[model samples]
Target chain A: EAGVTQSPRYAVLQEGQAVSFWCDPISGHDTLYWYQQPRDQGPQLLVYFRDEAVIDNSQLPSDRFSAVRPKGTNSTLKIQSAKQGDTATYLCASSPGLGYSQNTLYFGAGTRLSVL
Target chain B: AQSVTQPDARVTVSEGASLQLRCKYSSSVTPYLFWYVQYPRQGLQLLLKYYSGDPVVQGVNGFEAEFSKSNSSFHLRKASVHWSDSAVYFCAVRNSGGSNAKLTFGKGTKLSVKS
Candidate 1:
């Protein structure tokens, strides 16, 4: 079975530029998540979707960041105006469901974004 | 809000030596805990998890973690270390009563093993 897949393994952009990261989750998984990992730090959850609906996006930076899992299968995270601090690896993960102790997130290799 | 703390930023050990990585969590109630390992240039992978029941839960690659409710700690352990075990390990937790899918992670502990 294929694991979570992300496109554009690497991206280099300048400040104020826009970029989008795509993720295709594992088949049969009901929950999908997006995380941002800055250098030397663990990945932090940005937003997540349970099926076609967003379950939590409280941590997302509203002004420039947006995410969509329209069909509940594939997801896209967009940054309207990138910043130097936005340079990080964007990761996507998936799990079977939200049931307690039933979910085990499977992650993708992640897209490394470098904003100048 | 729930949070996780990995006190050690890095740990170095020789092959065949025992290893222990500590993790602490703060939450209003008992939270579901997990340990994930990330290889170089790769994504994070689950090593072990703890919800309820036995404090010790075995995970992949002969790794195990003991959950101590008394101290609100979940520490990863291995009887013997291997050079292949070098990687960054993250400690995470999620509210059991709330959204079980959302996780809060620690800064991570990078383990280096010397042969």
Candidate 2:
């Protein structure tokens, strides 16, 4: 099976510019996640979905960030009026299901975003 | 709440030398544990996971990790490492039996293998 795919491996934007990232998870996977990883730091969860319904988005920056999984297979993460701190790699992951035994997540190469 | 801690920021080892990277987690119970490796400009790839039964589990590329319940630690070990094994290794933990899908990861340890 093909792994998760992310578009535009890298992006550079000026402050206050808008940017969007696209992700296509592996086929037949029911759960998808978006994470932000800064340089030299671990990934931090942004949002997640379970079959088109958001499971948790508490960590997401609601002011300028939004994510949607319209068909439950593909997702988009958008940042509005980008800030310098928004510079990071955005990663997408997918899993077969919930629970301990089924939660092995497969990740994509990630989209590196930079705001100047 | 759950968190992972990798005390070592970086480790240097020569080719064919034994290596060990430490990981400690904070959780009330023994949750699912995992070790992932990330090459430069690449995403994370699972090395191994621990759910139950075995304390020591083997992973891809001759990697293995031992889960210690008494110590709340899951340390990864490699008998002999090659230059290709040089990468950032992250230790992650997830609470067992949850629909949350939140995997807490440590800061990661960058391993450098010199020939």
Candidate 3:
């Protein structure tokens, strides 16, 4: 089976520009997540969805960051007016279900975004 | 609420040397602990997980971790490491009971295995 897939392995943009990342989770997986990983840091949760319904997004920078999983299979994370601090790798992951036993997430190669 | 801490930011070990990566978590309840490895641009991969039962849990590629409730730690260990073992390892924890729980990650420990 194919693993979680992310598009535009690399992306570069100027400050104040916008960029969107796309992700296709492992087939049949019901939970999807978007995380931002800064250099020398661990991946931080930005947003997540469970079958089309957002579970948590408090960590997401509401003013500029937004994410959606309309059909609950694929997800898109968008950053409006990107900042230099936004230069980080965006990772997408998916799980089989809820709870600890179902918490294993399969991740994609990630979208490396750079704001010039 | 739950949080994970990886005290070591970097660790270097010669090939065929034993290695251990420390991970500590803070949670009021019985939390779910996991260790993940990231290779350069690649995404994080599950190395091992601990939920309940025997403390020692083995994972892929000869990696293992022991969970200790008293210490609140889940440290990853390997009998011997190879050059391919070089990567960034992250320790994460999630509330075992919650409606919408998310895994909290640590700063990560970069292991550089020398041949």
Q: What are the Cα lDDT values of the candidates? A: 0.93, 0.93, 0.93
List candidate 1 stretches off by more than 4 Å: A98-101
| Candidate 3 local lDDT, A1-116, one digit each (tens) | 99999998999999999999999999888999999999999999999999999999989999999999999899999999999999999999999884554678889999999899
Ranking by TM-score: 2, 3, 1
Q: What is the per-residue lDDT of model 2 for residues B5-96, given as tens digits with 9 covering 90 to 100? A: 99999999999999999999998665899999999999999999999998999999999999999999999999999999999999999887
In angstroms, the error of model 1 at A19 is: 0.7
Candidate 1 structure quality by residue, lDDT tens digits, A31-105: 999999999998999999989999899999999999999998999999998999999999999998746534578
- List where candidate 2 sits over 4 angstroms from the true fold: A98-101
Using DockQ, give the best candidate's number: 3
* Clash pairs for candidate 2: none
Identify the superior model by TM-score, candidate 1 or candidate 2.
Answer: 2
lDDT of 2 by residue, A1-116 (tens): 89999998999999999999999999989899999999998888899999999999999999999999999999999999999999999999999874554668899999999999
Q: Write the per-residue lDDT of candidate 1 for residues B17-71, one digit (tens) a residue.
A: 9999999999888788999999999999999988889999999999999999889
Q: What tens-digit string does per-residue lDDT give for candidate 3 at B58-101? A: 99999999999999999999999999999999999987866655
| Candidate 3 chain A lDDT trough over 10 residues, lowest sum | A96-105
Q: Predictions ranked by DockQ, top down?
A: 3, 1, 2
**A10, model 3: CA deviation in Å?**
0.5
**Of 1 and 2, the candidate ranking higher by lDDT:** 2
